[model samples]
Target: MIVIQAKLIFLNQEDKQIVLDLMRRWSSCMKFAYKRLLEGYDRKTLKRDLQGMFDLNSRYVDDAIMKARSTLESARELGKSPKKVIFGGRDLFGKLQKRHINGKAYEKLKIRWQEKRKGNLYSRGDKSKKGNLNTRIEVRKNGTFLRINVGERKYVYARIEAGYKKNKRREELLQEIAESNIPYSVELKLKNGNIYAYFAIEEEYPEIKITKEKGVIGIDINAHPGNISWTEVDEKGNLISYGNMPMPELASGSKDKREYFRWQYAHEIIEIAKKKNKAIVIEELEIKDKGKRGDFSGRKSRRIRHSFSYKSLLSKIKTLAKREGIEVIEVNPSYTSIIGMLKYAPQYMITKDISAAYVIARRGLGLQEEIPDNYMKFLNALTVEELEELKEHVKKTVRNKHLKKKHLREINKAIKFLQSLESEPERVLKPLYGTSFSTYDFWRVLKVAVVTPLSPEKVPRDFSTLKELLIQGKWGDP
Candidate 1:
């Protein structure tokens, strides 16, 4: 179920007000229903009297009542405490947000839709509390142009490209379903003040493949843009691929653009899992950078940390995996990186980050702590010239391609360091190819992952003192 956002455009004030009225009524209905739910009123009781409680059409009233019940029920199942949901819930944008019209309503709202170019059908918040629920719109897709209905049709709606290509993904999904697939749900959203739509098309069911699985892929997320690290492993807990794939890095950009990059990166990781027919594993972090802000706090750091979008990444991967019938496992995130740093980094001559991924994969597989003794075979076999060439390969290929020029001086400094380590940087940082290629703090955090069981949350960002600690062999064999 992929959600697409489009700016719900309004051509006139009257139409906007009409939408506003419908949403207000919807909110009234939700309030009534939620109150009844709290009073121990069952769905039957609420549904029976919903139309009388709100000045809305019967279908709209039914949708509001049923959806409210559903919302409260789901919260209860998840052990969430009951809280009053405000009108146009902050997450739902507006009242019309939960309204779902069946095929009959769609037919009533549309005179005609050119399936090939676009479809003009009217909708309000379909039930969402995000973006801009500016007005109700009949979203069009993939059309050369949009034609506005100025009372020519029964409804006040704007024509748009059937598949708004701003989100090319929506276009693709719409195209895919144009044939014989059934859509599970279609949602309308007020996304960032723009009218957007989410199209969830159901695919044909396939034969069940796994009662149990052997292979697993583990992933670790970083706060910095494009700092995702992952590894693949076999059933025996043997590492299959460590730092073999391109790291997906979001460049410094707009929020929408950054979200899109993270999405594309998830797809790349999913592709690897699909190829291996393995389940996906990732650290199940409930909190991010909790209580870690410092005295020298800066706006940029705060924004970067806050906007990491870990939840979105997990959501995207899970949705994709579900359709493909793959399993996703979330392991405890605490100390996975430290364990990786100690156990797997040296074995594969990779950075602590990738080693963390390796450990995550192993933990999901229910494997023990031991690393394969011969894991270093590939690194040991590489000659000095090959090692230097590999170092340069990362400096140019991965580094130049993934790192943003905004941090060029810092990146160049790190690249120059990699160049200096011509023969063996592994003795210091894990294999440059695996981790430190993108991370600037190879000496500090990675070293902690190397020796200490789990570095204090307040480990100095500066590496000078940390470097001295590492040289003293205070932690691990490294």
Candidate 2:
């Protein structure tokens, strides 16, 4: 979607106040609807109640509820408590409550806070309304204008100016609005005593041109090293090329700067794919909130959680890929890291992250991964007696080395998988891919049992350290 920002010029104070009044009521209804939604009210019920409680009509009320619902969903996704969310600017609210600084400073802050709280309006597009009924934009012979519906058959007219600079995107959007019946959403905001209108229109994308039939470039986003690693593979699943893009400023920069860098990163990857004439493959990975308030998550966890915008970055990549007609493929993220570390990293002598990218690329090509013969033989040799001894070894290592809970869990899970296999020697575990290969559980057993403790972070970057273990079927010294 493309968004056009323009200044709204009102002819008279009365017309401006009419729009302002609707914005105030719309903001108020939004807060009320959010509270009711949190208190177990459905959208239908809240829509009816908001119309009665606020001055807004049905459509405005619906839009308010939509905005509030989106805010709530975002908060939940970030693992934030809804109760702690400040409707306006939280920092400004805190400053005002503290009563710090007097006179002009205080007044300026108060005005900004009030504007943030009550000076916003939103109206969704409706195709049946010829675009949008509440806030409609039309280009006439004289100039472009906006007709805003404030109340019962009451309307306010304002001139809209998109500025003097040349903007091809804006011009294209305007042409689309004038030529097609496609709906466009509008949002009005009062910024610094001036009214700004944001118009959003969806853009059509071309058909897929570059596809996996030729090759695929797989991407792996790593947090510890703060780099995006990519590996290109041929149609036969052979590695062709690989590289890493370091993003040192991604975690510590300002929000705007970080977002700009993300766009640049996406552009770089897409350009590489275009150059190679290959499709792009990335894991469909979802990074949920690291922890809640007062959870005392570690510094690394917090930094990674706040710094990386996985969804945003992935969306940007996919959007740009669509515009470039490059096919983008998303594969299951499960065990990509483990499979990469165990199977590909040692064999290819590459970093774990790059190895993971290789696995992602190969998976996109519809290839099945087979367990190494040596590793399979080791699993087959493990009896309940041997598993018990390994369990004792893991427990001793954990107690002596003071390993974290996660390490213990990993080792224990692997041991359990080994125990399950003792009963069924010829057992085959099938995953969602519906292949006759062993499940990730079997791999995890090998990882903890034989691959030098097999933790992604703890394992040596030179995966050759574990080469002897994998080749000789000898368990690592825990």
Candidate closest to the true structure, highest lDDT:
2
lDDT of 1 by residue, 351-396 (tens): 7678778888887887665322222322233244533443444355
**How far out, in Å, is residue 376 in model 1?**
25
Off by over 4 Å in 2: 99-103, 163-176, 285-304, 382-405, 419-438, 453-457, 468-478
- Best candidate, TM-score-wise? 2
Q: Candidate 1 at 108: error in angstroms?
A: 31
Global CA lDDT of candidate 1, please? 0.51
